[model samples]
Target chain A: AQTVTQSQPEMSVQEAETVTLSCTYDTSESDYYLFWYKQPPSRQMILVIRQEAYKQQNATENRFSVNFQKAAKSFSLKISDSQLGDAAMYFCAYRSRGNDMRFGAGTRLTVKP
Target chain B: DAMVIQNPRYQVTQFGKPVTLSCSQTLNHNVMYWYQQKSSQAPKLLFHYYDKDFNNEADTPDNFQSRRPNTSFCFLDIRSPGLGDAAMYLCATRAGPQETQYFGPGTRLLVL
Candidate 1:
């Protein structure tokens, strides 16, 4: 079974600054995928970024990027130029070479003015 | 527009009462999943359907049941609503097991 853990329960970042949310997982599978999802006050889950384990290069999406450390079982999200819209609960999830996706506890991000 | 849709965004039910939540998808995905999430907690998988075949999580309680009658529709039926069941129910779909899952805006259930 794969388990994901996000140590930070809550995080705050000043608007326009950068913030990183840490996540680590334990999985025996060699091939897998990692993802970051955001849920706002509307309670809608939105995909932020995704990384494939086979790829050594990290994944970057506009203002969001991931530091995917396959060997260390770490995948963290970095939000650059954080905005109010970035204030939401961020979840780190893992999908093994097989398909069942499991999620971490999540970190509630707050962007301060 | 949201590719996945969950109807009755907010529901109010009495204890032991039966409640049903519906999900519809336009993404033409072959897999659909149901998840339960309480306050400040990770979403827990309840069950999922790959086409018409249903797969329930081993730890899922008997109080929760699911059905997918066709390609685009699925339902979550809670036979006996308890206070513990009062939480957001999320529906997700993917083209296949390895594809990214697209989520619908969750339905919030309130048990009284």
Candidate 2:
């Protein structure tokens, strides 16, 4: 079974600064996808960014990006220019082709003004 | 807006009582999923429906059941609620097997 692990339980970043949340996974499948999801206090889950295992270039979406290292089974999320709205519980998820998705325990991100 | 919607944002049920959570989607996606998330935990897959085909996770308890009457609606029925069953239930929908899933705001379930 594939599993995702987020080592940090909680993280804090100053306004306009950057923060990186670490994530690692255990998967034998060569073809898979990694995703970062944000769940705010409202309890609504929102997609942050995604990275395909076959892609060497890291995926970037505005201030959110991922450092996906397939060999190391590491997929970290980086939030640049962090804002108050970024405060939420961030989850790292994994999904193999034609399979169910799994998520990490989650990292609570706090943005400080 | 083509989004997933869950009814009764919050619910309180007594122990041994049965409860049902409803989910509807405007996206008209082919797949709908139900996930249970305990406090301070990740969401766990309960079951999913691909059109009319029901798929339950291997470890899901038999006490949990689901119904998808049509393309737009799905329901999660817990036969007997327990304190341990109290959690946030989330609903998600996707266009295809490997498509990105859009999640609903979730319903907070409290078993007393």
Q: Chain A TM-score of model 2 versus the true structure? A: 0.98
Least accurate 10 contiguous residues by lDDT in model 2 chain B: B93-102
Residue A75 deviation, candidate 1, in Å? 0.7
Chain B TM-scores per candidate, in order, are 0.97, 0.96
**Could you give candidate 2's per-residue lDDT for residues B1-112 as a string of tens digits?**
6399999899999998999999999999989999999877899999998889999999988889999999999999999988999999999998986688889999999999
Task: Write one digit per residue (lDDT tens) for candidate 1, span A1-113.
Answer: 78999999999999999999999999898888999999997679999999989999999999999999888999999999999999999999999754689999999999999
Which run of 10 residues does model 1 chain B get worst, by summed lDDT?
Answer: B93-102
Query: What TM-scores result for chain A when each predicted structure is judged separately against the true chain A?
Result: 0.97, 0.98
Q: What residue pairs are clashing in model 2?
A: none
Tell me how far the alpha carbon of residue B70 in candidate 1 is from the true structure, in angstroms, after superposition. 0.1
Model 1, stretches more than 4 Å misplaced? none
Please provide TM-scores, in order, for all candidate models, with all chains considered together: 0.98, 0.96
| Alpha-carbon interface RMSD for all candidates, in angstroms | 1.2, 1.0
Candidate 2 lDDT for residue B43: 96
